[model samples]
Target: MKKILALVLALALVLSCASALAAKVGVSMPTKDLQRWNQDGEYMEKLLTEAGFEAELQYASNDVPTQLNQVETMIDDGCEVIVIAAIEGSSLGAALDKAAEKGVKVIAYDRLLMDNANVDYYATFDNFKVGVVQGEFVEKALDLANAAGPFTFEFTAGDPGDNNAGFFFNGAMSVLKKYIDEGKIVVTSGQTEFADVATPTWKTDVAQKRAEDILTANYADGKKIDAWVCSNDSTALGVTNALEDNYDVDTLGWPIITGQDCDIANTKNMIAGKQSMSVFKDTRTLAAQVVKMVGQILAGETVDVNDEETYNNNVKVVPSFLCDPVFANAENYKTILIDSGYYTEDQLQ
Candidate 1:
């Protein structure tokens, strides 16, 4: 009986030690202003905690200084691993240096961390493919290849600070540029350049003002725009607002708009015919993958990464795990989003 009791106590002590050694994980998101970031933070926190890790989640309100400070604090607080969704990709070099000093592992979440060899892993959707999907959606809608004459379209891309912005813009442009060269599509606003059309901070007001200017200059006659290829939901929201506030979309015909993130407002707009489609990269699946990666890392096992050559952060080729993205529109938002429990019907309504 005493030997059995001793065995029980040993098992209890082992369990106690395991609990005490649970590694703390830091999840730093760019902003809570966007619905997707909030969901990402929540999901990462939940999944990490459930996986028996201590999780610290924070939002930086889209401020680079705030994000740097938060990451510094996470490192100082003894976080074993830190996951960052950068407000600005190139701005985290110093903080990552600090993390490296403390031997903390870094994972760039959603957004790539630039100019830093300290980034150990990258986990995000295939962002260029996201743009390709958006471009394809526009292609199918306009029937660009099969159709005879020209179609009018506009561009509204993401923040210049985001590294993914170029990937998104270039991927879409790769498909649509050929058509433009062939005179199969026209840029009515004459704002085709990335530097000209790139929105700062991906701000809705900024994009809306730009769109308003373009409309005033070129679309005042209520000429129909065939499409607007926006990099994400917020910019698409701006374009939709510009159409509503400044243009006679009813008579001129609402143009097809492409977006990413499948944001609540954008999905509602898709339902309401204001926005056309969004790229759906489900965050829960990504969170789960990151959690699994965390376990592998802590266990001193090899972490699963699919793409080793794609994401070059200007320091080294950062290993990456790229989740595939698909288009979500009025037609399949029900199955892809609501039914999959990514969002509920009422939340969208």
Candidate 2:
């Protein structure tokens, strides 16, 4: 009896030691409203935990104050490092200031955290390349280089606050602008600027309403629009929903709608011939890289970064590791999304 009690106490001590030694990591996601974010948060938490870290993941429901409060709570909860996917890139300065005071390291995940020097590193896809892929998809689908007499084009971009939104719009514009200038493409409503076309919070309903207004004003004459460059799946979903409600597919036909994230619904739409293509930034790859980075940061090793000059966060240039992105359409989604195991064939169906 005495020996058994001693052994149990020894085991308890060992368990406590392991718990105390494990570094606590705080992951603050912007929202669970978007499926991609849900996946990102899940991946981050899982990978961090698997690497022997205590990971706390929180969703802010797209609320800035709630996210700020969550960050503060994590800091008080003894998190040594925090990963943030900001709802608004610039709104986290105050929260990060507190983190800096406590000597907490910050890794800006996916979205570039802006206007604050507290950010230690950035992990994201090549955002400009994401846009470029989107733009290139539009150019190729329309045969803009050759077959266009005059094609109707429009833009429904992402949140104005996300630093990535600018990169996405510019990359696509760089390809399509020449066509627009040559009169190969027409912006019927001329809502060409990012500021004008950006959806607040990347909200699908907002995008749908803006698209509806554009259709009501510009395409009411029954001439079909050829292409719409949407920055991500949420906006593309919005535009798709709006287009379906307002236009008749049998008579009007679907436009070449380009998006990012290859979201499940949008994938179904692609299979149904509604959406043209999407930029697939596999979150699994990014999550693994971020876990590697967190490991390096804790181990006092030099973290890996590929691009040191591209991402300037208003205050300083953030050292970043950029993962590459590729576009997926109906023809290649099976290979890129399914065979590679990012999604099951059943999930897509």
Candidate 3:
């Protein structure tokens, strides 16, 4: 009896020691409404769990105050580290300050916060590169169509509140502007003409309505619109749906559409020639890298910011890890997303 009791006690001690070595991490994501974020959250959770750490995640749903309160709770719960996909950089100042006061490390995931305060680290894709790729694809697609007689193309941007959106827009615009300036692609009616850019939430319904309005007011008036440079998959769905159901858009040769986030539906559309291409940022690789960072931080080791890149916000330089972005069209769909086990062939089909 005495020997058994001693062995039990020893086992308990080992378990306790293991748990103590594992970090307690809290993750606050911007929104769960989008498919990519959902996958990101799930992947991160699984990775953290496998690393023997506890992960507490909160969805802001684009709500700043809610995220702030959640962070405060995490601090009170004695989290050692924090990962935030901030809804808005400006509103997260107080939460970050509290984390800093507690000496807890923070990582800005996918988007850089603008507060100018010290953010420990960031993990995301090369968003600017995503835009540039989209631009090049757009120009190529247009040229392939031999889109004759100089027609005006429409521009639809993401929500202006997201800093990443601006980066994406700017990246694509860098290539698009060159053509616009040289009279290759004309800018027709959009946020510029309406005096407020198309900064709608990532809702297909809203994008569809916007496209319907454009077709009704502009196309009906004898103005022939040519291509559409949609920012992401959801917006592309909206524009495509409007064109198909409302306006018989097939007659327009399915303008050069763009998207991101290799959602199953979007991938199918790309395969079927309904959409153009999407930027494929492997969430599995991203999740693994973040888990590795957390492991190092938990083990009382410092993050190696020397090799990581830095991006400036309003006040401070944010150390960031920019992962490579892969452009996926019909050619590399199976090789990139399917074979990597990000999703199954059946899910996409």
Q: What do the candidate models score in CA lDDT, each in turn?
A: 0.92, 0.92, 0.77
* Candidate 1 residue lDDT tens string, 1-349: 9999999999998986596458899999999888889999998899898888999899999999999999999999999999999999999999999999999999999899999899999999998898899999999898888998699999999999999999999989988999999999999888888898999989999999999999899988878888999999999999899989888987877899999999999999999988899999998888888888888787778999999999999999999999999999999999999999988989998
For residue 206, model 3's alpha carbon misses the true position, in angstroms, by 2.9
Candidates ranked by lDDT:
2, 1, 3
Model 3 weakest 10-residue run by lDDT: 190-199
The TM-score leader among the candidates is 1
- The regions of model 2 sitting more than 4 angstroms off are 1-21
- lDDT by residue for model 2 over 293-339, one digit each (tens)? 98888778899999999999989999999999998999999999999
Error of 1 at 95 (Å): 1.0
**TM-scores of all predicted structures:** 0.95, 0.94, 0.88
On lDDT, who's better, 1 or 2? 2
Tens digit per residue, CA lDDT, model 3, 1-349: 9999999999999986687566689988878778888888888988898778998988888777998899889988988888888877667888788898999888888878776485888878888888888888887766723555465778666766567777777788877776776666777664432224455556778888888887777777445566777778878888878777655555656666788887777888889888888888888877888888888777777664433444677787777778888778888888888888887888977
